[model samples]
Target: MPTVLDRLNLALHYAMETDERVTMLGEDILDPYGGAFKVTRGLSTKFPKRVLTTPISEAAIVGVANGMALRGLRPVVEIMFGDFVTLIADQLVNHSSKFRWMYNDQVRVPVVVRTPMGGRRGYGPTHSQSLEKLFLGVPGLKVVAPNALGDPAELLAAAIADDDPVLFVEHKLLYARPLLEPGKGDLIDFQVEQTGGAYPAFTLRPADSARLTIACYGYNFELARAAALDLLMEHEIFVEIVLFSQLSPFDLAPLFSSLVRTRKLLTVEEGTLSLGWGAEVAARAVERMDGLRVRRVAALDLPVANAKSLEDAILPSVQDIVNAALSLVS
Candidate 1:
């Protein structure tokens, strides 16, 4: 019955308990207010010295975290909004991500930068932007955008335990949903689950024979799921959906094998179409496989719209994904 926010907080608690070196930093994270979305609630009280509240500077927050990582401490820095990440691009893309390689593995920067990303709920353009694609292109940075509530807990634990810098992008819309069934193992239990193991992989009951694959991340996974249901009920066409919680250092071996069986691919993202993650996936698919047809359903190639109606217009909808799937079948 725990909401996504509750699960995230639990994950943080587990991280703090497991690692004596783990620390958290950001605005409004220390005391009463608990974080803008309350994901960091009670953490300040539980780990007084480890949980730090900072000024309004994203650059400073990331810079301080990078310095800490250099000194052998794992720092989890929270950026209240994804849109604010642009202001600290130099710190993230230039410094933290490059330190290890730049120094020939002489230093390892273990920093997890968490930011609430995506649109909807009228946050408008300034506060609502999906910039995961921007960080995905940078070398030495691990990017993760977990769609399921349970995965965030596990994935955050894994990212924190990693030696490299990670961009843990949490979707704003997914924070209020119920915990995903598969990732429901007890937080106190530290057993490692097998790869590709599913608690319950929802399959379209009818099972169309078409060779089309739907790949998506973050909130777009929800839209793709709804569209997949519609495709099964109305069109009798079934497509396989591969939801990736871990984006950078993407393990595409499974996806590539699936693609060989399916023969067609469609990528959906909430971010802009041009130079987005979808584009990279499509390009990689083409390069790795011969005679593969791939398409992308993403936000229009324009600046994020400030108006709610225009914002909705720019983002990929269920209809868009469905149409793309249908096109692959046709």
Candidate 2:
């Protein structure tokens, strides 16, 4: 029963052990401290030569990783905090992502940038944000966020092995949570199934037909799932939940199939509201399904406050999903 952080560390360990080309670099990722979240714990102890501790510069770290990737190496970088991902935008979006296509498929950049996102422990505005949306539409970059319902280790391995550059996002809150093992056993009242893909999308289905389908990613699913279960028990309102691991190359098949059963959908995310993940999902869904009712629950367009109470009020919550589901269904 390993935590999400444990699984991620295992994946890194396996990748480095099996693939001589794989290397990891970040700040404060050495012995004792390991990493800010300890995902790199024992990695340096195992592979001291490959595990590098650099200065506190996101741009420099990504630049180094990008170069290493181009010259026959697979580098997995840690941003320390997800917010600093912006500093690496130029090297990542322009250089690392574009090289393969720009070279007319002559080469591949197999680099994975891992970072923790979302707000729950009050890291404040800059430190606690879901900025994946900013990198979503980039031509050659792939955005991935693993959830509690699938094998994050497998997905991380896939990302490391792939020929393209991937931005691996981890919800900070998810590090300590245990992931539900796929196909081992079903939940008490819900049937959980995952789509077979490099990065899987898990669907949690209730016994009866659903009035609404709630689609979310990362830590937001935790809140959404609780709200869905509450709606079913307290109000007898069945809501199907679809949780996705890959965000950029978002697979709408699972969601579309759910919509076929439940005509309505409520997209929830921890990211800010206007022009965000929810908006894109809702728009793409409408293009495929006719008369498909949709609603989005997301954080307000304001910086996450440092205070716990203020942060909780600003970010999306279980109550918000419950209210949104009720409104969409009725």
Candidate 3:
């Protein structure tokens, strides 16, 4: 299996080849260097007319993509860092995201804003923060993320083709890891099943599982699985892991079923602890389900530090997941 970055690059190639309307615009996305992370390598070379290298302004990049999307072009824009998403919030939240509804469904913004998020490479606070929390509840905006459970390329392809505005999040740390397929690699000991949707959610169940389910997405998912392995091997604590790729239009279907069996949920995320994705999940579960206990593990509310040690402390770790799981079960 190819790495997440490989799959994403392949998705771009496939989308551009099949759909004439598909286009990409961003800074440094051209051939050779390929957009910082190289997710767009060889694309500009293939479709020189459509793949545009924009200026450094993130706001302008998204604004142009929004205009293209409204004009019947499916434009996938890239932000160099996820932290810079703030600069384009107005363009995204007020204009592009609301265009369809505000115009009474006459014009559609089929724009996919792809950016690398999460911290690990010590890129400092400006480039290393996970800011998807800011867009979770935005009307008409779909938030999608990819974990290693399945082919991320498929998810990216789906996002690019969707009619509404989508925020596609690529965790920086997950770029180089191989996609975790069912019955292979990181998921070998577990039974992985993906739900049916444009962005599928994966549920991993061990043959012998405890009454606790750990739910996470993106890069923290890698941490959760590792924590689960150690919890099972060293502490005899088994847990079911549910991975979600879709954040907005929040679908709890994949998780509700697991909660039915386990009746215990531990939501883990790289975002901060206050008013985050995990909070929404926990709130909805308590409202819809009966006799469920939920706990959340996320980064500290403070800013992400550039120092590796402080950064690690601010961000949730494998030990955090392990301890949270034990607390949930015990």
Please give the CA lDDT of all the candidate structures. Answer: 0.79, 0.90, 0.91
- Rank the models by TM-score, top first: 3, 2, 1
| Residue lDDT tens for model 2, 1-330 | 888998999999999999989999999999889999999999899999999999988998998988899899999999999999889999888898999999999988999999999888978999999888899888899999988778789989999998899999999999998987644433566788778978888888888988999999988878887898789888999888999988986668999999999999899998899889889899999999999999999999999999999999999888889998889988
| Alpha carbon lDDT at 6, candidate 3 | 95
- The segments of candidate 3 whose C-alpha lies over 4 angstroms from its true place after superposition are none
Question: What global local distance difference test value does model 2 have?
Answer: 0.90
**TM-score, cand. 1 vs. native:** 0.91
- Please state the error at residue 30 of candidate 1 in Å: 2.4
lDDT at position 180, candidate 3: 73
The sequence of per-residue lDDT tens digits that candidate 3 reaches over residues 15-97 is 99999999999999998888899999999999999999998999999999999898889999999999999999999899988
**lDDT winner:** 3
Q: Tell me the number of clashing residue pairs for each predicted model.
A: 0, 0, 0
lDDT of model 2 at position 95: 93
lDDT-superior candidate, 2 or 3: 3
